[model samples]
Target: MTKSRIRAAKPDTQPHFDYFYDKPGSLPGTLNIGVDAQPPVIVLIDYNEADATRQTLATPEECLPYLDTESVSWVDVQGLGSEDILQRLGQVFNLHPLVLEDIVNVPQRPKVEDDYEDHLVMIARMVIPKESGGFHSEQVSFILGKHYLLTVQEEPEHDCFEQVRQRIRYNKGSVRKLGADYLAYTLIDSIIDGFFPVLEAYGEQMEDLEDEVITKPTRQTLNKIYRVRRELLNLRRAIWPQRDAIAMLIRDDNDSLISDRVQVYLRDCYDHAVQILDMVETYRELTSGLMDVYLSAVSNKMNEIMKLLTVVSSIFIPLTFIAGVYGMNFNTEKSPWNMPELNWYWGYPLCLAAMAATAAGLIYFFWRRGWFENFSDVQDRTSRKRG
Candidate 1:
């Protein structure tokens, strides 16, 4: 099946949770889909030890024949755009009204539900790395039954399950021989593993941001830092509950839907969830540190500029005083004390020499105090500004 059946989310890496809120007084089990949503694509894969088959079905009713079979059946629905199609799938799977509501709802948080006797439902957030420096995320709902697993996704594109699909098609592992519980575990593990590559990209972006925060922080740098923090918060919100959901799966051994063997595998999947949460937390802290560093850098740069300007102003103070005293216009003819040097031919030259000497002395004093050396940052900024 082509992975391009779903549309790409917006190019930005923002929270991908599809929030579903009904009218305040709306009845329960109401299905609300985005008007722009595309009709869902249904694909069925039925397999036993000896045979395996894969086909795209036109409608959800076509999945009924395989759902009751002894062999493992995987019904994959790729979109939640069509309310009629979703309602049909719910009926075909004998889904509870609330379960149908949760499934159709874009995002109902990351949790695992086993209230229904026939199936175990797992709601998770899956992320796909985008080529343009961010990630695309969506909701993946898993309904695992005795002999079949029904998987529904928010969108059909940017799929992270191609490897699992390949493994199932080629029988690379025991996924074919195992029950739907194992298939659920495999796909769950794949979904959790999908977070690693996305986290790696975040790690790289944060490293670049660390340098940018210190070297030369700009408004754009601040914006990027804010985005990284917001996105990481979204990631934390996603993976935090997911860890509890996975834990619930492992702890709820009474639910006969999931085999003990698969639960063991789920333990490892839970570990991955915990690991992803740690990464999100670590990145969040790093982004916060980047903000602090940006502020300090800007403040420090401003201080350097103020220091340079102070030194320049200090050097001119004495020269201004000398000129001010000479311009007082005292009449030398009235008294000797008025201005003894005013009639001298060398007075103008002496005054100019005095001003030049005063400036040089102030400059030397500031340089001796190491104030001039501190202006290196200011000098660099000035040079760049000129350039």
Candidate 2:
């Protein structure tokens, strides 16, 4: 099995900037985007209660006319490789300088800010599906205006907004009746709920590790437990700040951009965030206990090894001394005192009998004192029973 490697990460090694930085206090609406980003793909979804029109546009300027229209316009930009296109996108959307900078930055902390413009900027994170049971997450920024919502994703392929698109296209939900704020809420809620299945998978893994660590801990087992712990820490870091961001959205009395109804829904999203936090915390605690149990298990195995060595030495040390004494020749023919036993007819049998008695007595002593029973129990539990 391929397990994630256990490596230590220093605070210094943590990311200073999630993405390449633009100069501080750069002109408002200036685009200092990444060089390696893919060319932006714009998906325009214009919708109202009676009708909806979805189109793919060639340039950011093409979506400009609908921004001031009566219907709700959602301009979704995925991928950010071309600086020229991104800079134009900032102009077309009339985004604040800081808002544009936040969108281009790949991994900004999830946040919501209102800078006294016609927009409410929300920095939400999205986690993509992992093929190998691991996760990769990216940042998605939402700029909500009076009649339009502009969304920009870090990468082209990582998207979780398909459900919201379907809701609008198929008119499956109340999305058509709501404004851009509701659309923002729907997308944000989807992003928050995305963490659940990932967290559930982690919970199951930790439960499995709990069994694996205690029953048959090895060096490899230690690595796996630590890997799980490290990943949980990452998950905690992701979910915790997100919870605070959502809380801020609910608690901010100044940002009246989100209506009371949407704020109520944001409360539900907060609950989900709380649930995720609880699971991450619980898993962390379990992982810590597994570490302790692994240490004790390793120590116990070492002790058993020492005990076996002691038992072997105790049984053989005296026997070896007796054999050594007999093997010595002290001039037996000239000294009767030393040669009396050696000359006896049954001397060999008597000496063998004495060794046998000595071995039996030691064995009985160990058995009676429960040392053997303890060893047997350890073997039975570790070998015969399923951990």
Highest lDDT against the true fold, candidate:
1
Per-candidate RMSD, Å: 7.7, 7.0
- In the range 1-387, model 1's lDDT, one tens digit per residue, is 111122227545454343556665678888877766668999999998788999999988899899889999999999888888999899999999888888877667888887788888889888888787667778899999999999998888868889988988888889988899999989889888988988999999998998888777899999999888877887788788889989988876535888888888999999889989988998988888888899999999999999899889977977788778778888888899988888889988998898789778988997998876757788999999999
lDDT of 2 by residue, 1-387 (tens): 111122235542223234334455555545545556788899999999899999999999998799888899999988877877888888887776667767876666778787656777788778765767757777888888888998888886877788888899899888999888889889988988888877878877887877887788889888878777777777777778889888877875635578888888889999999998998899889889999999999999999999899989987998788889688766767877776877779988998898889789988997998866766788889886775
User: Among these predicted structures, which one has the highest TM-score?
Assistant: 1
Off by over 4 Å in 1: 1-18, 330-387
The residue ranges of model 2 lying beyond 4 angstroms of the native Cα positions read 1-36, 252-255, 327-387
- Evaluate model 2: give its TM-score: 0.79
lDDT of 1 at 17: 49
Local distance difference test, per candidate? Answer: 0.84, 0.79
